[model samples]
Target: MVYDLAIIGGGPSGITAGIYAARQKMKTVLIAKSFGGQMAHKTVDIENYPGFDKISGLDLIEKFENQLKGKNVEILSEELHAIVKENDSFKISFEDGKFINATAVIIAAGAKPRKLDVEGESEFLGRGVSYCTTCDGPLYQGKDIVIAGGGNAGFESAIFMQNYANKVYILEYGPEARADEENQKRANENGKIELIVSADIKKIQGSAFMEKVVYADRVTGEEKEIKAQGVFVQIGYSPASHIVEHLADLNQRKEIIVNHDTMETRTPGLYAAGDITDGFLKQVVVAAADGAKASMSAYKYLQSKNG
Candidate 1:
């Protein structure tokens, strides 16, 4: 059956949209590869989300999913391949050669962490190198680990790792950290965290997993090696928008360009929200707000078409 609205992700943005759309009695279907998106693997405790002093990333997403359990929103575990407009409707294609037609579409695929692209980085993924500290930090309890980056994500991971790891080294390529002052203060207070600035990771060495990090000082061009069992890379993130690249307009960073008010893209029936849209801060609260705006715009668009 054709759905009234097809949400293209299952993260906070899409799930929140599904909740809103379904509550409106609109036929909504949530198509996603997974349930939680990036929040699934975070090992840190999140206090930013409302109504909770502290909660695990996965647990919060699970609560979101549980809220929609009995709703009309149909949750499908499918990988969206491409989207195309046809007449007044939209057609969504899946990787398994399946198709779904909808009157409106909300694209909320979210983003993935940027890779270091250094030697042994790819091979050591999960084995010793991880992108989400909340997911893999506990595995390295009382072990030495290296965090590559000095941004908010890096500092957050460092603070989280202090709970489990014996020592945490933050290897940043810049002279100073880019993390928020509050987060930086907290990281500094944690005696276990060692901040190494202006250093670039040259190589991640190990046989089966990551065992050491070869770093080079950007200023003096001096080389230094640190022995560690695991490495958490939190340099930055790239939006997951390649599939819809041809269908929408993107900004300089390749993020979807949308009007802030309506969340409408270049296409009328198409809307984008969350980190996939061009923005500086990628936060869960902002994503939820975007989803609400997109849903309202979508509802208005549907009303105009029906009227």
Candidate 2:
């Protein structure tokens, strides 16, 4: 069946698009590998999303999911292998060799956390290593933990982890922390959070659970290991833009390039939103707003094409 709009993602961005498209009477179907995407895995406190003064990340995702329960949008739990333009429409291919066609496509596949790729990193995933600061930080209460990365994510993670962990140490490979001034200021003055600059993460070692984190000094060439029960890897994030790499123009970070005002890519009838696009911020509210904009743009494009 050919759909008027097919959204690729199940996160807040994708769901928001689906809701808006349904309200507009657009025949839309959503393909999501994991419902709620990575947001489902987050467990930390979220106080920014409107309405609730404070809530867990998972809880916020659940609330978003509930909003689409009675919507007219068709939701599918499947993996998308690729998206190819076919004249006026786009064809979506699944791993099982099935194809779905759509007049307009909105890509909101979300982003995945970058891994350290160090030894024992994968083996000790649930045991110690974690990517979601909100999901696993509370579990390591009263324990010493380390965070790798000096960006905003790292600093924010350090600030969050400090609430539960006895001591939080940020291991940054650069000479200084690159996080925002606010997070940096908070982390710098916090008694429980220590910033380790000019450090290179070498390996993660443990038997059943992570026992230590190893890093080298950039100039001294001396390696150091810290005793810790948990490690949060916050180097950066990689958007799920591989499927549309050829269909759209991607920046150096593999984020889809789109018009800021409309969220439309260089390719006509194709739009992108959320963490997958190179926008100002990667927040839930912003992504949902993008979803709304993309759907409106898609609706306008359809109207113009038919007229």
Candidate 3:
């Protein structure tokens, strides 16, 4: 059967789009390999979502899933392979060899955090290595922790983690930190945070859990290690727009390009939202708003085509 709309993610944007589509009385199917994307897995505290002063990422994801159950959206847990446009409709193929047709599509597949790929990084996952400081910062209360990267994300996380970690070490591989001057000043002023420049991360070493982070001095060419209980990676993110790359236009960052006002891409009947799209801000609330706009735009496009 041809669905009226097919949403290609289960994150906040996709879930919100599904609800909005259901309200428009559209035959919608939401397909995602996993539910809740990064928000569910990485975010620990969500205080700026407007509805609740604070909520765990997993808890908010649960509420979104619960609300979706009462809607007319069909949920599919499958990995997408490719999307091919045929005539005026879209044929979405899955890695499992199954396929489905839809009149319009909304690609909300979000991005994933970039990894450091150092040794022990994978083995020590959940034990001491983490990608989201917000999720694992509290675990290292009164302990020392090392954060990799010197960009806005790294410095910002370092400042935020100061509340939990006794000492926050910010390591940068470059000659100097790349964060804004303001962030640099704040981090330097904070007694708990130590900004280390020209430090190249080598590996994470520990016996039971992560015990130390090894790095090399880029300027002096000397190796060193920092005793810490946890290592937080705050490099950046890579958008998950590979599946629909052939069907949509992508920017240099591999983010889907869409009209911000309507969340519609260059291709008619095709929309993208959330971190997958080229939006300035990557937040849960912003993603929800994108989803709402994409669904409404899809509904209007369908109405025009059918009439």
Q: Which candidate gets the maximum TM-score versus the true structure?
A: 1
Regions of candidate 2 where Cα sits further than 4 Å from its true position: 50-55, 138-142, 181-190
In the range 1-307, model 2's lDDT, one tens digit per residue, is 8899999999989989988998998989999998887668764466778988988778888888899878888888999988999989999999999999999999999999999888889988999999987778899999999999988888888988888999998999889888979788888675999889999888888898999998899989999999999999999889999989988999999999999889999999999999999996888889999999999999999889889
Runs with alpha carbons beyond 4 Å of true place in candidate 1: none
lDDT tens readout by residue for model 1, 177-213: 9998998999989599999999989999988777999
Per-residue accuracy of model 3 over 266-288 as CA lDDT, tens digit each: 88999999999999999899999
Select the stronger candidate by lDDT from 1 and 3: 3
TM-score of 3: 0.81
| Candidate lDDT values, in order | 0.89, 0.90, 0.91
Ranking by lDDT: 3, 2, 1
By TM-score rank, best first, the candidates go: 1, 2, 3
* Model 1: colliding residue pairs: 42-134, 43-134, 43-135, 44-134
Clashing residue pairs in candidate 2, if any? Answer: 43-134, 43-135, 44-134
TM-score per prediction, in order, is 0.94, 0.88, 0.81
Candidate 2 residue-wise lDDT at 218:
95
